[model samples]
Target: MTPPTGRPLPFPSGASPLPIPSPPALPPHPPLPPGAGGPGARGPGGAGSTGPAPGWRGLPARLARRLNRVPLRARLAALTAAAVALAVAACAVAAWFIVRDQLNERLDESLATYDISPRQLQNQLTACSGGVEVPSPPSPVTVQIVTAEGDSCVGANMIPVRVTDSDLTVAAEGPRAELGPYTPEPGEFRQGTSADGTETMRVLVRPLGGGGALLIAQSTASMEAALDNLVRLLALAAGAGAGVAAVLGLLVARGALAPVHRLTGAIEYLTRTGDLRTRVPVEGDDEVARLSRSFNAMTTALDASRARERDLVADAGHELRTPLTSLRANVDLLLRSERTGRTLPTEQRVRLLDQVKEQLVEMSTLVGDLLELSRPEGERHSTPVKVVPLHSTVEQAVRRARLRGSGITIDTDLGHWYVRSDPAMLERAVLNLLDNAVKFSPPGGRVEVRLRHGELTVRDHGIGIDPADAPHVFERFWRSPSARGLPGSGLGLSIVAQVVRDAGGTVALAPADDGGGGTVATVRLPGWATGGDADAATATGATGVSGAPGLPRATGVPGVLGVPGVPGGERDRRVPDGPVTPIRAVTPARPPQPARRPGPADGRGEGTGDGAAEEPPRS
Candidate 1:
């Protein structure tokens, strides 16, 4: 399920036809139940019994709520339309109000024209001494004015419309002869809406000389009709604009999210192939651009991981084939001897079996080491780094080294120093170094292995790596020319380097210090970074990007002897010839990581069986 986006709804509908949100409920005010003053009187959940409370609950309610997660594009389209609609409505309303007010002002001016300008009204009031300046009198307006209750008043024809009265009250006060009813100011604009429709009339009333009022307003029916028509036209225009805006918003949404669709397709392709070589075209700078950048980074990382995996498997297969071939050959030879006419004596058979057993043991150990390295780094034995006595670990490894090569003599000076390392891995690292030293030393040659100030040096008295071979000396499957006749996988030194480096140590191979006779492998482990005590530390993920062709392709030939095609997998093929030449062969190193601290987020899992049986090489 996708996570939630915390955005407020603009025009929510709680089952309303218009889709406008209902007004917010007024918050509760403090009061209490009748006859209650304490907490116990409160309703359950601290709510008071009043109108039906609102909220969602149960299945139907939740499903209704889920309508809220509609794709953002669609939601945004809806919101845009809503905003445009509101804007247009507001504009139409404002235009109608402005036009209506303008029409009203014009109608008022017409009425005033009929009644009198200050000068005309003044002339007429004083016109009693002049002739009829307004001959035959002007048309009537809604003339109204305040008057003395029983005073006489008049309009133009003859000073005779009774005392002036309010325009609204005049007809109701009495017949056309009543003295007075309503109060109407003479100079003020007299305006009134008609009873039946928007039709109206106006008349001017001016008292010749009396306590009365004068008022006037004209029939404004045409102006009212014009304003109504204008309002309807404005509404139509506003609606048209809203429709156009909606269509444009939809088009914009579709265009803006086009890259998102491309991104989705790219991710699907990579997911299927486990390849990250494809580049997402960089576009204009925006949030989407940043997303593209992040995706590109992820793909690059995956691609690198895939390449490393391919290399690891190829290298591993190259390394494992030798020991396995030797083991198979040695076993077959023992069985063949048994099949011969002479029944092997127990002593001889025992010797052959013993050799088989020893080889088997070595194979088992190598397989175990391979498995350790191949498992996800999460599974690698982890221990907090702490101070550990270096002398004990060196002494133990040296002892094992001496036992591994009965014909090689070793010399060593064990010295005390502290280091931060997992004891078991450190010991294994030291052992691998010593074993490599013995292999390089000629039979009966003296090999020197010493430990001092946390640095262990293993020098041999045999042919060393050529200068040209030094660069890849520590890489997986890399065997040197001088070691062509050796009997071992070229994995020993590589494992040593990884272990040492992982423990914050360094390993390098160079000409020996004394007379520069053989390769001297030196491991410099970090002194303890903390004061905690050291304890025994005990020590592969997604599929390979592509296969390394585990089995050789069929040539379509029927029978081929001594040419069995072996599946290609991970193993170093170039076998180390005696123990002297130290060929470093590694398992795949991890891919680069971000600023992220290590975690189990990689979906790593444990493996079964000797992970070393990853298939052997055919070449």
Candidate 2:
């Protein structure tokens, strides 16, 4: 009875929904083209109306695009030519107007001041009254006489100019009394046509002394001819000038862009050949020369980077080969015993396994060092740098060193110092320095660690480094001949150097200044005494660490030992007379043990191989 719940109740139980009348369908419209609604589209009147014309509106834009396709030198030449042409055309037009004005002024002056004798005028009037032809003047001037009653007469062989009301007025007034030798009589000058309507003339109307007016007229045909000739000459000159300008512009553009052309060629050569040795020749002190010099410097740097890359690869291969070979040999020995049904001694088996583990650890350390060196210099500090307490970082490193070298004694004398740097990186650098000293120290030998102002020194009483080897100790993978037999990857000092350099500090190794038979490593960093403003210092992002009370700040000068702002002289190196609170000596974890020498199980270390006898110290 419910009509299946969702069937619209059977259209309201057979009453049926009233059929909704369908609207009539209209005609369909054709699709419009792309951009039909844009500026070029039809107006509201649809197909019958028009929108703005695109042709003239887009002309300048279209022309600009075409011009852009032209080469730079050609564009420069064209612009120069256009500028010169415009200038020449303007000058020509101005000169033509000036000359026309000058000619017209001369003609008007001569006509206005023309002399006429009274006797000649009387004879002309008598001839005109008797209806006889008046004699013409010697020149081409047309002379006529008009009476106050509007009667006129013309000379024989002369053109009669049309008379107007102004002439009649002049005839009735007689001659003007204001006439002077330098000034023409009062009259009006006008352009008029001959009575026969065949000639154009310049007419001047002047009243005669007795009773009528005289008209003087001249033809303008010769003056027009002269002006036309001048136009032709000026146009020719302008055309010639424009042509010459275009040629000179092309030459100038070619010469000025010569350096740019050479630079482009060098860049192309380098790109095609993958060579960084290509250098552009620089000449003059212009912008182009500076660009060339910059290009040369870039190539030099790239070449050096490539050289360093090659050396690192070769060194890494050499370092990895020894550990891998030893591991393979040991594995094969174990596999051989098992396959041959031979039982190996337990002690020997355990010892070989321990050796394998140690070698793996050594290989792991070498790989980590390689990865660190391979990272981009900019990405060395993965975390934000901050103002770090230098003394605390040194204490942490010394603790680590004591743990590593239990048989050695490390004495620390640290002072309050703060430096802006990545805290972890700075600590790692200090630890490496301590490790170097610890590695070289003999059993029960004391290692003195001291920090004052912003300088840190670590001294060890061991066989001193050879002066010849000191220069190369910080080079990657360089192990001294004497230290080659010890266990090390030879990258410790290299990493220390990189970190210290990035922190805007300096590190160096030299024989003990006290004449002790050991090496002393000194690190100098810049910083101010006291806490100062931590936030301000962090914002400044200075590389050097701060100094202690009563001491001048380290100058932060790379490889420079002198402290800046010290009165009179460089700060003395002695521990300033302050309470020297020496850290209690750390007890040895085990009885003092002699240093281990390299053996077959030790492999040859990361940077030392059987063939690396001449290598420098890993420290």
Candidate 3:
């Protein structure tokens, strides 16, 4: 799953010809995808054998993964929205609780805030004790009290409750709820209830020191109406606050991410122009500025790589001219001779024909190398890399080099070793190294091959390259001034470096620091294996790595090669870093290459990998 990338780049070693490192191993996966294990069924760690260990189990990571699949802009917006909504909701709930408590507490406080005495209440009670009960409004807050004389009640209007003999008896023992200044005394008060059911009686009762009692009542219709209004106002405020907060939050989010919006527009502009040089005009040096800087850096790097690519092509064209010129001349000579009825001696004609064949062969070799150089990037050959024998492959490569070179003695101190790689690719890489050793070695000087573990070092005792030239040695078509007279296409080491990478190995070139100076190229590989099985890769080379190294260890079964050369149709026989992200391209397919300079990244691109730019585990 592709997640939002944070735009941090890991450094790739520059100029040193360092090989790509192998990736870390992955832990085992979980048993049955979630829910595949039935309810109550334990995971492998929990006693079921079908899952990963318990300590490693958790939901947050999985949730992150799930969320990562979401578009970053949308994901961030959702997170912000959810946070704001929860905050506002919590505030609303708290406010509701606070308001409710206040209303209830205020009502209770009013009931406790009275100063009327029991004696005054008794006098008032006595004034009406033997008379018939007066009618009153229903109590907004229920009011009733027990006095020494008997139990009595008042309604909202400071009148009496519906005191039927039975109701009076029942209410004498019960007050529905307490409210107001429940003074025991008959304070300045009024009893009233409008016909429409408003209740306005505030009543309080107190017992005298042992036997006496008093009751008082007042009308509270106005206060009840005021409190009711207050409650409605509070409700309105709560609703308004919540609505305002939600709206404000959304606006705030939009404002905060304004830079991102601007960046988006700039990116669109760049895409339309197909120019990475276009950049967002940065504001303050914030994360957005950092992002802009990173983008610029990336583009600059890409530009440099592009520049290098152009140089490679130009250099290749220049080197190609010679073989092509020779081939054309020979062909013309043969054709012209055929047209002219010149009865040249049979031996002379045979010689001319042989010359044509030799020139054609040379042209073919040059063309092959050119083709290796021309293979495009994003080719779909994501192949698995494995251990390849160093000794044998180099030996075969040494013999191959002999076929192409003259008067070169091959020397070696070697042992069987294997590296993670494709055999065809690894073999080509070694061959390129051998070719370079032969080309630069003094006509009769020895070219030494040393293999230890998975490292192969080739050294020649000839015109050693300059330190300055060493930097550009593996660059396509690069050559040294000291070696101007030497016959070379300047692509051998480039192919060497390219294929080494595909095989998940590193290649380095340096002038022999030893008193006997010459150029030394070293290739280091991973997935080193020991023993007889490695013969398939390295034993074929000269002064071969031979000894009793053990048996080959098994890696997984390799898949079949699809289209071996084309990137789009090429199967996973090249890149070992899993499947390529995009399986297709906008293409004029890879251009045809002249077939001669055959060292590999295909030729390892491990392209140009498993001959040009491919890597070991990464290819």
Candidate 4:
């Protein structure tokens, strides 16, 4: 059932036929008319009518691809060698021409000086009449006389030059006034072959008396041999120069590309080994140096990111284990009781269930915090930044703290302050700070929360932090040694720090001043002086038109928390067990000082001026 060439096999009746395989077909072109092909006429699809259309449009692309196949070092070396060879060749040609012109000028001057008087020639002719042979005038010089009758004379033992029409014309015309043909000039010369045709001569003609001319011929064989020797020497020198230039070019290219090779090797090693700590060495401040610096910076960033990820995973696992273990234990206890067929007492059973529920809630909170902190700085919940009232935010946080800390008295002193930040995140940060204060406060103790301008401070009247443990409070999953028994995942302060930083502010912790027996957590955020509507309002002065709702009119007192009844001379409405500490009405203090930077007395998150995260302890 095999198919024939270029055809499909026949199928039986009611049987499916197999499809034949073929190469892709090009679009059909219109038929070309015979004998219409001519210049500027296009074929089908605008292609040429030649045997096969040329691919000139892709010529540059093809050349680029071919060039890319060559090693960069070899290309650089070859190019340098070619440039040097061109320059050297140009200089060699110029030198050869200069030498040739100088030699020709010297030879012409020497030939012009060789002249013989008619008397000397007559004496030589008379002596030779006795059959006495005379030697030639000189080895390469021939003396000949040309007369008006187109005849020639030669020195003894020298062949006479065959007279030509040029010689007869020169003799008839006499010497030219402008140093024409028969006139001998310093630089004028002519070249002709001797009658014997065995040698070429450079002839100079000098006129004699009675329409006669003397032709002195000098052989040019020696001059031509010298020029040929010079040409050979120049070619040798040029070749040697080209070879030396190639060697030097190769050496220079290698030296120049050494750093690039090192960089390539380092990057390859890093890729193969999955190592982020590798760095390329930098030497000079050139372009390569800048590239090296950038590469080092990239690797450093990768290493830091990897370390952060590792820390997050480890901390998350550690925090999750406790709650999970508690849940499992409680579940096992209930299962055992059921298996034994013993009905546990109602109170004990209720306690076990409650414990399980608490563990579940704790685990859920831990997971949420982990997810929140895992995102990079820009990816926190996409809460839009807006002008928010800081005073109202603090008041709201205080109310929440009051609910959480039942026995503790919370005091608040806030001045009208506004800031541009994500209101939701800012409130969360404030709540965390207040909750932290309430948590650490002793039963029936007072917690002071104050905000003026953009600075906010939360102080608790509990056991303050030890000097040794104050440095790890804001680190992920870091718990104080004394507070390990507390029910916290140790992520609250970390969240607070991150939120404040995202809002372009800083947070720091220190022991309360004047031996106060508690820690003070201060957050400084950049803010507008007024409630964002009135820019002219001072810190102590209140502008009530656009303030947060449900607040009493600000009284004459400066720096007082504008809560109801507290201002306008009313008694404190809601008092707890501790002393009624009146919220300080701060007099117009020098425009709220800029955020205090961390120094020897301050415990910052990252322990640096830039306020990166640090491992400070929490109380």
Most lDDT-accurate candidate: 2
List model 3 lDDT by residue over 169-267, tens digit each: 333343332232444333322243322334545444433222222233344655556566765666566556655665666576676667787778777
Write candidate 4's Cα lDDT for 526-619 as tens digits: 4455653323233334322123221112233212222222456541233222211222211121122223233343222211111111111111
Off by over 4 Å in 3: 1-167, 170-196, 200-255, 278-322, 336-355, 370-431, 442-446, 449-456, 476-487, 498-506, 524-619
Give the lDDT of residue 388 in candidate 3. Answer: 53
lDDT of 2 by residue, 122-165 (tens): 45544444434345546778777665555566555667777777
User: Where does candidate 1 have its weakest 10-residue lDDT segment?
Assistant: 536-545
User: Which scores better on lDDT, 2 or 4?
Assistant: 2
Computed on alpha carbons, the lDDT of every model, listed in order, comes to: 0.52, 0.65, 0.50, 0.62
TM-score top scorer = 2
Off by over 4 Å in 1: 1-74, 94-191, 195-211, 219-230, 270-279, 303-341, 345-351, 375-387, 402-415, 437-487, 501-522, 528-619
Model with the higher TM-score, candidate 3 or 4: 4
Q: What's the true lDDT of residue 567 in model 2? A: 66
lDDT of 3 at 424: 69
**Superposition-based RMSD of candidate 1 using all C-alpha atoms, in angstroms:** 20.9
TM-score of each: 0.57, 0.69, 0.53, 0.65
For model 1, the local distance difference test gives 0.52
